[model samples]
Target: MSVLLESRVNGANLYRRGKVRDVYEAGGDKLVIVASDRLSAFDVVLPTPIPDKGKVLTKLSSFWFGKTEKIVPNHVITTDLRRFPKAFRDVRSLNGRAVLVKHCERINIECVARGYISGSAWTEYKALGTVAGETLPAALLESEQLPEPIFTPATKAESGHDQNITRAQLAGLIGTDLARELQRLTLELYRFAHDYAASKGLILADTKFEFGFHDGKLVVIDEVLTPDSSRYWDAEVYRPGAAPASFDKQYVRDFLVQSGWNKEPPAPPLPPEVVRGTSERYRECYRRLVGKALS
Candidate 1:
């Protein structure tokens, strides 16, 4: 399969090119979101494009948006390319890799929910007995389950890593009412997804969500519950005291850390093995979660 690192829709006006997706404005209050095969680690886009990666991501997000829509409204208008605007409709390359969604005023907060302590949460808990400055039980292990899922909000940084913020701080940034709604929705979505993944022999360790204002109502925007936005681990092999196998970009992050490349722009290219392994991991994640092959 061909890797699409950059999408060329020819006539669609470019909205913005994110680390992994290229968005373009369709007519009316809609946008076409194209998931590219480009993978980003530590907020830095890698040069190598993983084959069929974009299709997996696009289809998986659509799968999840359908599953979780009853829990909350979302921005998706259609995932079917035939229904897209005239310019985007006939592009064969856009078949499974692009979605048409309503344009919304994005809420700049990254709504995070953690069922397990790991990553930055673990680092902070180990050092200061807190996750996002909120205290947790004493002596939690690296990947141990939390007492319950907690909602941790973060800033949506334009570049580099998003910074975790306390719930109260989130309230301060946004109004108290809006912050509470985001927390409620984030935790609820996480719980629903967590339970679903558990039955499928996977752990929904933690995940983040983005929301936006559309037609004067709040709705989930961007991608949801995909490996790119969530952390997953195999249920049978999961251990509390150690770093579990990741079904996300954490695999690539581990490689970068070992390669001793300072986290900076101009990131190093992946080796052949790394590229193939990463591609396999993304595909496997799709297969397990969506209950079908991404093809």
Candidate 2:
């Protein structure tokens, strides 16, 4: 795997500098998205790179594109390093971590689906006894399994972290039809992926997906099912009442939590061991979920 240092798309207009990704205009209804090794926690990017982290995320997203294509259209065009155009071909070194995708008019919402109670869901449940701006049944405990998955949409913050919004708010922004479609598609995709991951002894706790309009039709965009986009927990160690041991970036989060650093400016760099461990966990997740060793 060669690591290309520079971008390939000419007339590349920088679109967004996300915490871990750089999106570039790829000329006419397309975008070149590059995943950096940058790791983020609490909406802050740490000052260290996790080796192979980008490659792992790219591969995982590729795997999921294939798995979920039956459910919805995706932005993926090609992953064959040699197939990229001349501009990108020379940058094959970065091919393992970058992708050229058809750009679409992105839906202005972050479509999230949760099967387990944790994270923001738990936080909201404790305070308001509901998730995603909706009330839930009584007797729900922290980390408990949700009776059913919920569609929790959040505004796609052009800058800074996204803020969660209610279903009604989502409908107001995108019209009731489109909002309902997003919700239905999101939950269906989550259910399919969650069951598949469960079969492999991993728990698909929750995930966020982005969608865009192409030819006036909805299509899934951005990366999916990667550690950076979703939470994975080890099924064997999963206990109902307690937080399950995570199979994704929880290790990094745990380290950060222990560091006692404010979750604000001047994010701290991770120790070498923590980076290695996180990278390994991502690799393990891809291998197990895809049932094939990543090249």
Candidate 3:
């Protein structure tokens, strides 16, 4: 299977090469973001690439962007290559992986919402009975649905892992009003998605979002609700007291942990089965959520 581990457009200046995406400057106020097959785990980019993974992410993000535009404005301009600049249009590999978007001054915060207890939230809850330093109801089981979704903000680190902050810390950093507004938006979006996912027979356990100020208006930016950015599970199989089989990168993380590689730089390459399984899961997520196969 073919995979685009990186992308290059002769006429477009490279803007930023993130862990899984390549960004390009596409003339004034516009940018071309290309998702790549590169997968990262424990803050390290792995050597093997998941086939067509980039397209799944790009397609899923575009679908959600269209679906949620009424709920919130986003930075998407077009996913159609013909609408892109000549240079981007010249690359056939970028067809389903690249997006044209309006440039924005990014807000340096990671807005997260959790409808179910899992991951670091479950970790924190087990240890301190608190998540993001906010106390929760006692005896919450692992993967148990919360009474209501809660907003947990984190710093968008320039390097390494993002540090979770308390609501008060967020208010102090970005001002109380702005912080409150971010929380409101995060929970509202999560609730909408969680309900929608349930109708599709999946549980949106938790997700994170990035926002930026475009023309002085805050809009959702980067990927939204894709498997890469959210924890999704089979609703029928979901159970409390343990993590369910997720349709996300958690499988890769599980493999790495079981191998005892010691989470550090220079991660190991994924085996053929691991790569194939991950690719299938990502595609399955797209199929289930969009109610159609990704073209």
Best by TM-score: 3
Instruction: Estimate every model's Cα lDDT from 0 to 1.
Output: 0.91, 0.82, 0.93
Please provide TM-scores, in order, for all candidate models, with all chains considered together: 0.98, 0.93, 0.98
Identify the runs in model 1 with alpha carbons over 4 angstroms from their true place: none
**Among all windows of ten consecutive residues in candidate 3, which has the lowest summed lDDT?**
1-10
Clashes of each: 0, 6, 0
Model 3 scores a TM of: 0.98
Better of 1 and 3 by lDDT: 3
How close is each model in CA RMSD to the real structure? 1.0, 2.1, 0.9
Rank candidates, TM-score, best first.
Answer: 3, 1, 2
Please report how far candidate 3 places residue 263 from its true position, in Å. 2.0
Please give me the total number of clashing residue pairs in predicted model 3.
0
lDDT of 3 by residue, 35-111 (tens): 99999999999999999899999999999899889888999999999999999887999989999999999989999
- Write the number of the candidate with greater TM-score, choosing between 1 and 3: 3
The prediction achieving the highest lDDT against the true structure is 3
Residues 171-267, model 2: lDDT tens digits: 8888999999999999999999999999998999999999998888789998898888888998888887778767677899999999999899798
